[model samples]
Target: MQYELAPMEGITGYIYRNAYVKYFGGMDRYYTPFIASTGLNHKELNDVLPEHNAAFMLGEEENAGSGETPPPRLVPQILTNRAEDFLAIADRLRQMGYSHVNLNLGCPSGTVASRGRGAGFLGVPRQLDAFLEEIYKKCPLSVSVKTRIGVADMEDWEELLGIYGKYPVEEVIIHPRIQRDFYKQPIRWEGVELALQQWERTGSGIPICYNGEIHSLAEYQALRQRFPQIRRVMLGRGVLKNPFLVKQLGQWENRLQATGDAGDENVREPETNEDNRGKQSSEYCGIGGYRESEAGTAREQRRKVLWAFHQELLDGYRKIMSGDQNALFKMKELWAYFGESFPGKEKALKKIRKAVSMAQYEAAVREVFYSKS
Candidate 1:
């Protein structure tokens, strides 16, 4: 099983990816948040600079001052309803060493949807088909799309899926919800499962990756049982709640390979000396090493991951923003997702959100993660 981290705009940037890689080390691919298209020539849209940092930030950099080969596996993502803009962005990303691009046709925000982009494009199949045709004609990299089922209703997906079947996209990532429902509703799995079968029958051969609401190992296992043939899965919110999930999957695979349990494998929690599990066992099942105890190893692991996450936010803030205003804006966005994991987290995050300066933000962060209380 392969895992890709979902691109949550403003939340999943270079620093976030870097921290994820350093601490989790299991994601097969990481995607950048969508870069909005701008400029008349679209050349600026094509210029990969700090804007391109998302694609190159993974892996190790030596000689602090030198530029060398990039280490992380990254795919550039773009959000544009216009084929010309998509092509421009793709061409530029390829020159910067990215061979894959994902179209953001699933974002549900009103401001984005109002422009006939993101989930809004799902409502118009002909326009999407036309735009894709133009993109295929000019793009230099493999193209994939991340999308929801429909703009406002599940009924709209049939025609939308038909349009997708005609294209040679590398992969189709389905979040399994209609646009109007936002991320709060249950995933429309029946629709997604049916589409997967249809896509395979047509011999599209392009892989299908499931996304959305994958909150725990049980959910992942159920999906695995339902679609045993699927080779790729994506995690968005689940990863934020428990960063160890992907690594656990990776460790399971490693254990399988080592034991030669190639088929009908039992995924029992592997027994190990308390010390070798690293971040996975320590943070996942909460302290007692997966044993049935509240203050066990799993809790310890969760605390460790959370601490690392907070420090990275500080590091990323310092690198990207010079003033408290910009840094605080970015930190608040992250707290929205990560705050759910810690005790008294909502109040801790609220304090950070209202902070007016770097000093205030630091005080709040220290209170939440570093205070003895």
Candidate 2:
């Protein structure tokens, strides 16, 4: 199973990606947050800069002489309704050594959708077909599309799939939610099933990856049980909520392989022992089995690791942003997702939110980590 980190606009930038690799590394690929090519904004260019995307080397042998490693397999993503602009930015990325690019058609933000980009582009199938036609004819890099099932109604998916099949896209990532749903309604897995049915029935040969609401090993296992054909998945918020999810999933897979599970058809059911595999605490199990007390110790170790990762983020932002206020703003944006991991952190998080200066922010963060409560 291939795991690609979903491109989250504000949260999955290079800085976050680097820090993630340094601490909890398991993602096979990391998609850059969508870079909207609106006349080449400085911030957008900086986001995809090769220098900023280099991978971090952890151990002495891994570091060797250079101390830095090659970046993860990164596919820069772009959000545009115009084929010309898409091709233009893709060509620029290819020149920068990227071999692939992903198109953002799944973003449900009102600002982007209202402008007839992202999911709103699905409303005009004719224009979208033309856009795909032009890009495939002249594109320099492999183009994959990340798209919602529809714009307003589920019926829109059939036409969208047909259009996607008509092109030679490397892969189609289906989020299985309409624009109107906007991450609120249950993921219409039926829509995803329909896509798989269409592809199998037509033999489109275009690979498909599932996305949306997959946050844990059990969720991923359930998805595979439902659709054994799915070989790739993209995770965004789930990984943000639990940075160890990908690593834990990988360990689970290795355990399955060691148990002689031949293929997707013979994948083992998740352990039924509630005591052994409680969803909330299963992440503490590494390669070998861990006792309940060991799990508690592991949780403490994870907290310390998270603290180090947090400091790396703060230092990274400080170097880039001019003012301490600007840096704090970035950290606050991260906590919106990161805070979900700490179940009873409301009080500490509130203090962090109300912090007005660097000193106040540091003190609050320290209290959050050190507090007995």
Candidate 3:
């Protein structure tokens, strides 16, 4: 029942990670938003500063020594096509005391794909294989790769996994969909199932972490029941939409009973539940046992998580905006992914999107959250 936080560019960062850990609390590996490795030099230091906008916020402890504890297992993910560039940033991260790095091959953003950096690289397996060989040869830390099933079609995955199985990567996080589908289709579970069977048969030893379209505890439990071999899962938009999903997945039946006595005698716990017992929220920092009830209780918990996230965003935004009023634009991007968490958030986000200054933006957020309907 191990869980890893999925990286969403311009969305999940240190601020989000800090708030998530403080509240909902069920992430084992926290991945930073992907860092682009196109430009390489000390001149670009501020662009990836651990204290600034970068996803890893270790600089605060590295320099300020605030005695504040670090978040759970923060790992920086890098996006690049050049082998040398990947090695260079890997060296930089090692210098920053990071032990493991994740390569991004799952990003479907048109810009990244157009550059043959993300899913696009899957179409060129030999090139990607060469790139990894060079990277692993010089890399100073352990490496993992987050990738989709294929670039444009299901047929592309066989070659992609073939390339992956040949490497000694720490783990292969797979989202069961082709790149062009872009989340519009149901997850290609069959594709993932095939990969799992092959991995087991080959005894690759590389762990396979499932990802994509997992929205609830039931869904996760069902998957585990069907494939008892899969051990790890990565939560993406599901965690954003329902912060308690991973926590609930481990004790879904008990939660169902706690929420409001379930009467269905047929609702029984699967055999896989015991295997996933360690994944309970209780295991993560001892925070567990939230019963899912009517939507009211759910909304309250959502509000609490959102409040913590909002406060962290405000703090991070202020630091980024200081001496640089232009830095405020970044806040708009933050709202694009997180605003949906707030009640009536769509309207608020729309208003904030058009705001020209901090004052206007504040008014917009207030109107959506504080104004009487």
Candidate 4:
């Protein structure tokens, strides 16, 4: 089974990916946040440049001295509604050494959807169909698509799937949400089931991958029970609460399959209230941290790893980012998910959110990690 880290803008940049890889490496593929292709997008382009992603690059011997590497597991993702735009972006990345890219038809932001990009394209299936046809006809790099089921409902999903089947799409990663639902709806497993049935019914031979609210081992087990044929799993924001989730899932995959068990005893089912996002982020990397049942060494390791990862992220961002504000903006985005894990740091978290400068942000961070409970 292959495990992937889903690309989330602002949350999974090269610094974040590199730090996560350094401490807890389990993801088979780490997708970069989507790069916009239609207009001047220097920021996104710079984010995926070879120098920023050196750790995920190939070894010196394997890469033949070019900054480019072989077909990368560290995949770059592109967002555009125009076929010409996609081709242009693909060629640029190909020149930079990447051989693969993922099309972003899954972003649910209002601004993106309003522009007829991302999931809004799903509302216009004919145009999307034509766009796919043109891109596949001329795109230089291998193309995969990350998409939602439909715009507002599943009424047109069968037709949409048929359009996808008509193309030579390398893979389809389904998030099972419509534009209206965004990430609020508990994942509709039936959506993926429909894709599986359609793929089989048409003998499309296209691979299907599942992505959604997989917060705990029980949720993952239920997904596997429902779709055992699926071999690829991509984790998204839930990893923030438990950075070691991929590692844990990898270790327990075989045991769960052999025993036909529902979940790991050490892991608890996360609350299903998507509105309360902080509740999804946990204290111990989801490994029963600080629990009495766990060994002293295990607790010590958790502390050491989490602290080191935090320091690395803070230090790395400061080094690469121009002004303190940019790094502060990025770190604050992370703490929105991470602050929940530091149980006794509510006031400190507030300070972090309202922080105006690096000094204020770092002071709040120190309080959250070091202040007395």
Candidate 5:
């Protein structure tokens, strides 16, 4: 199964992607936050800079290095309603060495949707069709789309999927929620099933990737069981909540492969018993039973990895931003998701969130890690 790191507006920037790869790498693709179409400004250019997007190479040796995995593939995502602007941006990205670009039609922010951008474009099927037609004709690089089911009504997905089928896009990422639902409501799996059915019936040959509330390996396994043909999936908040999620899922697949259980279907059925759902893999189990020592060591390693990632983010932000406030702002946004990994640390996270200076922020980070460890 292919796993993608979903683009998050204020969170999944180049710095975060690099840090995540350097620490706990498993995601197959990492998407940059949406670069809105305002021509090509300095800020936008900085986001897709080839130097910043390249995989992080480890070790000092010229040819030989530790057996660490390479960084995930990076895909630049752009947000634009106008075909002309999209083609321009695509040309720029292609010139910068990106072979593929993703069009953002899934963002549900009111300001964006109000401007007839993002998910709002879903409200106008004819305009969307025209936009795709022009871009597909003129774009130099491969294009993919990320979209919600519709603007307001779930019924609108039928027409929307048909419009998507009309284009030769790389892939269509379905989030299974309408613009009005945002992230609050339970994901409309019915809508997702409908999309799969429609895509299959149309024989579009364009792959469909599901994205929504998948937080654990068991959830992913269940999703695979429900839709065995799905070969790709995108994770946003869940990955941020648990940095080890992708790694764990990948390891699970590897174990299955070793046992010859991973066949053409690509996933084995998970144990259905609720008690076994949360159990650790047998590879980590001790002779007597659960390996507390091994589990403890792994947890400690993860803590150190998270600390290293935090320091990298802090250092990277300091190098780019001009002041403590700017660095503090970015760090706080990160802690919003990073803090989820550490439960019962409300006070520590609150300190990090309320920090007004770099010194305070550094101290709070140390406190959070130290307390957790």
Candidate 6:
């Protein structure tokens, strides 16, 4: 199973991606938040600046970086219905040394969809078909599409997938939710079943990737059991809630792929050290090498690594974004998801949310990392 980080508008920017790569690295691919057809703002441009994203790709200028694991590929995504605009963006990215781009037709924001872009484009199959026809003909690099199943129902998804199959789409990243579903629960897996059926019927050979709310290994394993053929999965909000999710999932996937095992057995907890076996472990499992209560040294190491990642974010944001407030704004958006991991830290999280200055944010975050659970 290849794990990817789904492009989220405000989250998953270069700073956050790099922070993730440096600490909890395992993602196979990272998509830059969809580049709006309106064009790149200074901040947005910074996101795709080959310089900022160099670490995610291998064979860079120095080819060495702070990332914990082998760096993953970075693919820039463009959200647009205009074929000309897509060609323009693709040209810019190609000039920037990128060889692959993802077309976004899954963004469900009202402002975006109102403009007949993103998921809104799915409502007009004819126009979407023409748009893909032109771009695929003119684009110089490989093209994949990240798209919703339909506008308000799954009825249109089959036709849309047919249109996609007609093109040389590198891959189809299906969210399985119609535009109206927005971000609701219980994704329409029937839509995915439909895609599989189409592949079986026509043998299009184009790869299919699933994107949804997979928050844990169990959710992912269940997905695999239901559709054992699936090998690629994209994760979004789950990564924010638990940064270690992909690392854990990737380890399982790599093991399965390497061993040729069915990987269907129950996943066991990491074995305790010979000296520490049979000890009562805390409920919390940490990304830090040491986890909860195995030992004092272990807990302190966990805190150190967590703080290191946070400091990198703070430092990276202050450099790229304009002021403390801008950095604070971006960080707070992430905290909405990141804060969920610490179940009882609501008050500490509130302090981080209400933080007005960088200093205040730092103090509150330190409390979050340092406070005893």
lDDT of 5 by residue, 1-373 (tens): 8888999977888888888888877787778899986576776688788888667321122334667555556788989899888888888787777878899999999999999999999999889999999999888788889999888888778998899898888888999889999988888888988988887787879988889988667787778789888889999987777777787678667877688564423222222222233445333221111122355665566667777878898899889889879989988987786676654445677899888988898888877766632
Off by over 4 Å in 6: 58-70, 254-300
RMSD of 3: 8.6
Candidate ranking under TM-score, highest first, comes to 6, 4, 2, 5, 1, 3
**Global fold similarity of model 3 (TM-score):** 0.74
Instruction: Give me the overall lDDT of model 4.
Output: 0.78
Best by TM-score: 6
lDDT of 6: 0.80
Best by lDDT: 6
Best first by lDDT, ranked: 6, 2, 4, 5, 1, 3
lDDT score of model 3? 0.68
Q: Which parts of model 5 have CA positions greater than 4 angstroms off?
A: 56-71, 260-294
Candidate 5: lDDT over CA atoms?
Answer: 0.77
Error of 3 at 225 (Å): 4.2
Candidate 3 residue pairs in clash (backbone atoms < 3 Å): none
lDDT of 6 by residue, 91-127 (tens): 8888888888999999988998989999999999999
* Weakest 10 consecutive residues of candidate 1 by summed lDDT: 281-290
TM-score, predicted candidate 6 vs. hidden true structure: 0.87
Off by over 4 Å in 3: 38-71, 250-305, 322-357, 367-373
**Model 5 Cα RMSD, 1 decimal:** 6.4
User: Clashing residue pairs, candidate 2?
Assistant: none
Given candidate 5, what's the lDDT at residue 186? 82
